[model samples]
Target: MVLRFLFLFLVLLYSAKVNSQLLTDELARLNNLGAVFDDLNNDLKQAKKTKSISQTTMAHYNLAIFCSNHRVYTEALHQYNNTINLLEEKKNDTLYAKVLNQVGSIHLELRNYNYAKDYFIRSEKAAELIRDSVLLALATSNLGSCFEKQKKYKEALEYQNKSLQIFYKLNNDSGLAIVNESIGSIYEDLENYKLAELYFKKALKYNKNEKNSRLASIYNNLGDTYRKTNRLNIGLDYTNKALSTAVEIKNTLEVASAYKDISKSYNLIGDYKNAYTFLQSFLKVDTENKRLQSANQSNALQHIYNSKEKESQIQYLLQLNKANKSQKLVLVVLVFMVVVFGVVWYLYTLKKRRHISKELDFKQRILKIELDKKQAEEKNLQKQLHIKTASLSRYSLHLSQKNKMLSNLSLTLKNSLQRNNVDLKRKLTELIKEIDFNLAQEKEWDEFMAFFKEIHPNFINKISNAVTSKLSPAELRLCILLKLNLSSKEIASILRLTPDSVRVARYRLRKKLPIDSKEELSLYLMSF
Candidate 1:
């Protein structure tokens, strides 16, 4: 009986180990797949050469993401449509549903609010069908954002709350961080800067020491909050950080927004030069966006107006025709009294009404012609917006790729340790610890650069020399790592250094830079 019990325990242990190994392997593959997706154009080329359906689907999805990033809505839409077709054949409903959400997101980014809402609703349905809480939460969160953009404050808050509840239940830290940020944005829009700041700070705490593009947005909101509270200096400081982060992430739109916020702060303080500088930046971003969408919306509006105007004219003309028919009948009835002066007056009035009707008909034709012109313009604008949205989506993907390297390292380390491979375990543990440490604080940027320089000496020198900022190789490495939001431990592992050594390097990097002691070194590096 004792032998039987021991055998059962061993079997269970082995089963558990196998399961863990499988999960880790799957995760690693997924991570690498995601990294490959970052360079979709190249991947597609390779996939075409291999004729792999999975690769094809992946390529299509990657292309869709790229299109979405660049604001190429139609192209993105096409890619997604093709991907769905491929996914359908493979019977991968889970991924299909996720793609639906992506489509919804693209629509939302394009400002097609109703279309966006429809897509999100469909995505939520798909998630429900698949019983995927993560997908459900993501769909709900997207709906909340859509409502927020539409200025449906109460509805937006409710959606956000729903998403937050799901994220909490799922114990998804990243989702929770996003929810916190969304909540903060709603408060900011409602003019409750205090509450907004509270939420922003919560999100910041959650996302600390990471290269999260969302953090830049939160920073921008925090700056706005500070400005609203009449803390101009604080506002400027935060805005600068936000701007720096946006630049690091290559998020032109957010960078433009940050500049506008800074300009507003400067304007409030009567610093015209700074304000003007920011305004120019704002204008550049705004003009480009407006050039893409304004004409389309205007043309659409004009077409609708003109169509209505023509319809109204037609109704009036019909009424005039009816009146003329009645007049003709009266004239015929009065034919016997043609010699009477009153009959002459009646005929003259009928002729005058006919002339007026002819002029009105002419105007209606002109209006219809104008409407056609407006419709054409609207199409052009839509095309431009599609292009821009697609462009932006690519940048977002790039950000994701850069951050995934650290995650991969962590996963690899964890796997090696479990395998009981002593050398591999030690190496992975060291790496995991290093990443964790870099992420432990907000000022590990300098340390990250030093590590980066050690890995890519040539690239660091090139980038450094190209820029006016004389950041040392170490500082530059730190800057790139900071952009990725690596934990100190992760940085150390990548650089093959002790945790203490990593800390000392970070200290030296900070001391070498010209920044306030309290300011985050990553934020400082981004400013350049």
Candidate 2:
């Protein structure tokens, strides 16, 4: 009877421990949700004030997510690093895994595929150690996504299958649905439209609540698969479903993405009017999202607050100084009257007034100098910012152009692969090589000449036509390299030519351009 009572007591204790763990889990979820909402509201100040390490870690993680969604990658990376450090310090293995997953996602968005893969692998390792089925599933799915992006369909399928198995064992319906959709996406990529559609439909059947964004994504995927199979009406139907679901959920970002998909579908079907309509909607939504994000940053409000606070402090100091000076003047006048009577006091007062005047003049001069120095510093900072902004903008624009060109080149390369046409493959390779060359020398003499023409529009056509005849593209490239003070070997390496060829090109350029026999090309090029 006593043994039976002890068994009952042990059972009760075990039950209580389970209940406590459950409470802790619920609290953690609540904290994470609160942090996410705070980040969404741009309440960073309040988030930092929470004092809980978990809360701060979650807040930083959420802010990273927010920044990444808005394409502010540097800021996202900053927040992600902070979150990682905090989570690591706490030794919160589960949260650490989750944060690593988020970091991987950001790196994926940044196109740092290798780094993304590394982070995902680390996340999977943590999840495996913890035996956290949900996180393990998440890590597997994310790793699958990275492989899919790299076009490793077989590997992607393996990872996705593994994730699906885990999700099924855990009865994680949402995860199962997502893995199915991902599998379908890979099938579509492999050009197995029927198989893709089958998987997508399978996922849809389990998507009862329509609460998951994966549902909308799968609908869009099905639409794309149908479009590929030349089923325009079916594609339109699925795209419309996606649009409806996205809108119903008030997922503005997803809504914009849906509109973009719809536009592409219509474009594929040659329905220009419908395509244009959706395109306009997509643009409008995107612009509104950007504007909303900028507004949330509150840069202007913070600047104004900082300025007002500084001005108030300066005013308070000025008032204090004036009071101190007045008291000193009164004390001095009293002392002078006691020591030497009214005449001496009057003389001392005159002398003191003159000394004060001189001191005031000196202070004014010093203020002027300080003001001038501050103005100069402000101008320098503005100049530096302008240069940095311009450089960043140029880099961004260049990368965009390169991406477009690379996409075209990839399509061309794929076509060559399909046809098994050696000549076509060689030509495509040459084209790709030319693009790489152009990218490498994008800011060469040709670009400078173009820029020069922009500054001097009247002579543009004449100068351009003249320059074209005198300088072949290779010669122009060599000239630019030379102007940059690069050696012949460096120029050759850049242009994939021999040093002897570069020298020949330089000789030709000197003959073509207005350089004298004794003139240094580098000096002349930099003169402008």
Candidate 3:
């Protein structure tokens, strides 16, 4: 018992070790695939920057195919849409048809039948336009699958037959195998077990060289057909084979389908215990598949929402850019108008200032001419006053000499009469009295004074107001001579008096005037 228990423990440990190794190998393989995908993505970005649109489109299509095969359906759909958009812009019908077919397959997997049909139809049209036989075959096969999903077996068969003929013409063994499998699935849905078996066998023969998930699917279909026909042992063998292939390829959906078929076969053969065990296994795998499917669906929805948001943002930015350009145009026009107005105003002010400056210069020249004329008239008047003053001085000197000669002649006559006769003494006395009367007369003095007043208009009145007493006529005559800058001898000669008598009269005049002892009387009088 101890040895048996130890053996069982050893077996269990070996099984666990194998499972761990399998898991580790699977993880390493997936990591390597992810690294390859990253490299491809980098190459795609570089191609876009270089504006190699053809290379960019090819890279995106390749990545989409890779993701689709790996069951990364959301990423696969996104990449496929990107490829389609690029191909459309380039008008590359062949490539565009290929991408549309792949996109339809993805929508069919998601159970979006309407979307799948639309894409498939569009792809078929594009392929037909470009005469691409391989692409048209693929698109027709996918459209048949869509019809099969909808339970329209007649329509599905029609499209499948069309695809099969094209595949034959092109010698595409893989495409022929795919179409055969789709037709077999539609027959199975119609409950025609014999016909389904026949097509499944043909698909298996064609798929023999293709070591892929599609081979596992054909195996699963074959297992289902045999089970429906009551071939229990054959059905179990085929179902187990399908499970093995699915595990090797890591195709979870196919694996679950194989498990379900195995469980059904066991139940039909009266192996209730084994059937229950297989059913539990099927349930576990199916649950895990549903969980993964749910996650993929959620990711796909999120991707669609994000794409719509990006399109909205692009439209908003375009409108804003247009508004900015319009505002800039208006601003430029306003600035131009302001500059033109400023230039016009500056030119007007400059012209006005020039006219004002010319007018000012003309007025200045006229004033200068008037001032010169007044100066000339004043000079002539001064010359006339100087001549008149000189004439008055000469006349005063002549009167002084005539009075001295007359007095001397009268004295000589009086002396001769006294020596000759007493009778002649009375006549000589009368003659002396007549000569004195003529000498005392003021006719010449009056003429000289009148001439002085003409030249020195305010001289007499100004001197009288300045003196303390009123001036006699003799003093007035003396004051006028002093104002003319005359010497005391010249003044005495003009007055017909001796120089001593003239000095004595000036001293008396000085006492009556407001003059200091240090001031010359003639100079003081001339100041007036």
Candidate 4:
């Protein structure tokens, strides 16, 4: 009796230990899920504040998925409702269909068959509108699952086949695997074990490298088919594989289901002790999972309630702050208006002063231009006068040269006649008279006087007024040459006289002039 009691005590202790381990794992999973929801909630709040519709919708969808995974049905429904509302507002047909499909899945999980069917139908219509074959395939596959849950095998098979066709066309291996698994479940329900096994094998082939939960499900389902066909050893092998995968992923629900499947396989294979042990572990894990789920739901409800209360208080404080800012804005506006008016007046005055200064500058510029024009005109007149004086000096030298050449010719002719015959002497004398007339031509002297008068219009009048006595033509010519700054030798050449005679004439003229004895004759003539 003591040995039997101890054996019972050990079994009970083992069960309790498994329950504790399951509870601890479930709590850790819940905490992780809560962390994910917190991050998503914060993102949702920011997206709403910034008016980002797409980000807000995605946050809502992800939060719904998290709630669904934790079996928080009501909270999942609330988040999915928010996602659907935003998607409807944006009119995003493809994403809207996907959200509707997710909503259907949530309803399916809750066992609301009729509601799940309705949502799946709506999702199909939205997907069809956008011609999105992938979303349509998802909706169709979900509809098959809904029908399968309701025991409508024919309807489930039809929808699954339709979804299968789309998945083939799209080459969606994941969708194909899901549809095959559902079809296999439907066949298993109808007791067609061969067809069920065939589909399960196909699902396993397609589900290679899939998520741990999905692979675990496929292994568990395949093991069930093997057990139904009395292949107990093969069934136990698959079930053990499923349990290992489920435990590794920390999926408490799948772990419990795998343990139950493993226990059933052992029982069918005549391994009663292993079957009993696995069954106890399954019961312990399942019970702990349910308790954890209940606790998590309660915590989530309290958090939401607190958040709503805090939000209302924050809204009230924001309103008060907005009112205070409005009053400050009025004061700021008054100061800004005064500053703007002062700046405008200052700019106007500065512009007016600049305009007046510019006008004065313009007048001064015009006056300077007129003065420059007058100076240029005077300079041009002086240049013309200098050119005329140089021409007259050149003409005087030419006339003197002509006179000396004629006198030399006359002397040569007279000498030639005296050496030849007395009769030719009379003819030579006539020729000499003609030469003298040419040498003293009044026309040449008049032309010289005209040029000199143009250069020095007031010079002759000034000299005549300065001198006490009237001046001879020769003396006047000497004074003009001296005014031109000609040397005594040049003056002698011009007057057709010897240099000594020109010097004597200059001395006589100096004595006649009313000037200082030390002053030069050229300087005196220039001043006059």
Candidate 5:
């Protein structure tokens, strides 16, 4: 039994040393004097790292805030103190002053009024060092809170008013919310419930986010005010409001207070069943609070245990140091080989990328050359098409002018026939018939259509597709003339038809097409 007991003791010691008592990395760094921590802490390594603080002050501050907000006051205090020590050089800094004020606040929460007052005074002095108005106001307000907790109403009021004025000038809602709540609490203690409610309401108005712990506190204070004023139902409502908010925030202290207040309010209202239910809840929270208090008491002993564990770690490191010499040499060789391989691999990849880039550039150059060749061919085709279109236009114009001359000559011969003998009349009649036959000839029109098709390859096909029905030969002739943008009179001369008849044919052609009636037939044909 004695041997077994010794064995168990050794196992416990070894396990404790190995586990480091579950110390967080930031906390462990804050504790040790050594630069080296463990294998995974290579990132923490630096020249003269031992002399400088291991954990950054900001890390400590954030951790402290998290712990404080979570009701892990012991860890919060530890982090806050170490952070202050690390920040000793900048005692006048705004963060230093803020941290000092926050430390006092934790003490205030713990009801250590003397220590709270001392820290608040230190915080206020630190703020004064830099003349930081905001920090000064915060420290002043916190000092007021500390004094208020101590029942020093006059001093509390003095400090609170000074902070309140600053908060108002800055238009800082959060600061206003906190200071106003503090003032309201003072008035409540003084038996001035009306004034307390007024300030509490002001605090609530300024506090935008309802989830805030400060909001819970203000509601709780307001409930107390109403309860003292004998407004039982109203008081119960506010207390329930506080309880809901405190529950949402998971603030153990405020939650406990809210539970207690509810029990008392139910008791006052003769709701014994509800009162009993709330009393049980309050007791449970109180038990948890007592446990936390016990944890707080054990925190000092835990700190000592950390020191011993750190010493053990140091001894373990020393033991490993003797064995690491050969291991380090092997590690160095492996690292050198890795670096050599990496360099070779990098050069190979760079060569591959350059090869790929050159291929891409060559392909791009080939593509650009092909694109330029296509563009030049298209430009040459456009020039050839334009010359063909001009030749077609000139041919159409020559036909139109020739028809006009033939019509005039036929009209003159008809008037000459009225003054002549039978032979001359008969000859004049034959000549007029020949002129009329030439004027009505389809050859010139057929040639114009053929030449037009070459210039505008798909025009006839597009027109056929667009027309509602198949066109007559005369209508097709009119379409070609319209495509050439010829006026109605010019088309009349070319087709050997009167201008009025040409206009009538154009209107009939428009009825067969898909174009709007308001649209010019010539312009519509030209679009195709």
Candidate 6:
């Protein structure tokens, strides 16, 4: 239960309360709700006082609907403006779109063409966003009405036909009635009375309500179309029916319209007496309507009571906004706190999880270090072994070259033995000296020394340090071979000399060293 409460609280903190379809349905039902101005005004004030935004919006919407229905356009326009203001910043797309359409309608009714078209376009976009076909159709129909009034017949028909198609597909009788009426008005304005009469009849056919003001309006339009088309008798007959229907519904505006249509129809038929009589009736009704509209302007109506209404309304709105400011701030602060708490809670849980894995992480790190140490030791041993193998191969190549040079010298000496005795002796002496010089200055010796130093990098330096005097290159070579622990015969063969001669060189090399004779020479050399 506690967990559930936390979840609910978080949900409330995060979620915005955009209005639902239920609010739209409620607003729709208010059109038929019979409430006077004073009652609706009271409802609006109470809703505003409570700071219930949805209720306030609905209240304003209801007031606007009633005012527009009663043809109190000034007040209706003001209320529609208020409704739009309240719904503008909301995420409630459906209700916002519907409200936009209503505001556009109010502007259209007032003949504020630019404002009406702008609002209709905005509503169209909002409808498209939510993919509401019904809202889309309604906005399209109103846009057609605006174009029609502006004398843009082509554009008016285009929009009207589009909306008509939508309404037909939806099978919406109300939408069909509205679109057909708009299309009829367009045709009527273009003086296409035949098409006008046809559409007006279609509008009547779709409209289920016979006693309503719309039926009276359709009758008036159809009658006017007939009067223009030279069917005066038929026009007079339909105009009388319009008057009857208007009188039945107590629609004062429609009654006035019917009277004017009848007067015009009578005039067209050359019936001056009937025309004059109906014209008088039309004038009386139209004058009374203007007077009543002027008289109806109260402190809230700007037509008569502009000053006090503006002052009081401004003051009331200021106080209402001031009161709402702190409430909104409080809500915002609460939301911020809840968000911060959630983040801190998440971090705390994450810390606990990290703590649980701490020992395992430490063990893994130790294993990684041990594996790295073994790998490093193995690499070091392999590198040393590779260096020794490379040194041995280089030394073997040097030995083979020396042996081949010695064999060439032996063959020359053997061949010289078959030459003339005197010349051969001279040649033998020169060749023997040259052979001895070449052995001392062996070309491969420098390269062998380089390879020997790689395998025993410090050997030559140690040999120099051991002897107080500088040794010849041959003595350095003797020290390196001793480090290799070669026998005397192997050293003699490598140097192209007798074993006894190699022993004499070794003895001479030892004499220049600082070591005791008791220490083994090869062992001493190997230490370096």
State each model's CA lDDT, in order.
0.73, 0.71, 0.80, 0.83, 0.79, 0.77
lDDT of 1 by residue, 256-353 (tens): 68878988998998878768866876776566445434543343334434544765898899999999999999988777576665777789889989
Segments of candidate 1 deviating more than 4 angstroms: 1-53, 89-92, 281-528
Among these predicted structures, which one has the highest lDDT?
4
Query: What TM-score goes with each of the models?
Result: 0.44, 0.46, 0.52, 0.55, 0.47, 0.50
Q: Which stretches of candidate 3 lie over 4 Å from their true place?
A: 1-26, 29-38, 66-78, 89-93, 287-528
Per-residue lDDT over 1-528 for candidate 4, one digit per residue giving the tens place of the 0 to 100 score: 586347535644654555567678667766675466667778888999989888888888887887786667788899999989888865445778888888898889889989999999999999998898999999998999999998999999999999999999998888888999889999999999999999988888888787668889999999999999999878877876777677667677888898788778768877788689879888877887777878877766665556666777898899889989987998899899899989998999999899989999999999999999999999998898777767776777677677667768978986777666667877888898898777767887787778878777999999988887888989998998898788887777667689899999998898778989999889989885
Candidate numbers sorted by lDDT from highest down: 4, 3, 5, 6, 1, 2
lDDT of 5: 0.79
Clashing pairs in 3: none
Supply candidate 6's per-residue lDDT for 220. 86
- Which window of ten consecutive residues has the lowest lDDT sum in model 1? 391-400
lDDT string, candidate 6, 406-464, tens digits = 65886788677777799877878788777766666756767776767666777677778
> Which is the winner by lDDT between candidate 4 and candidate 6?
4
> Which residue pairs does candidate 6 place in steric collision?
none
The candidate that wins on TM-score is 4
Each prediction's RMSD over C-alphas, in Å, is 54.1, 38.1, 31.0, 25.5, 24.6, 20.3
lDDT of 2: 0.71
Off by over 4 Å in 6: 1-38, 66-78, 298-528
Better of 5 and 6 by lDDT: 5
Candidates sorted on TM-score, descending: 4, 3, 6, 5, 2, 1
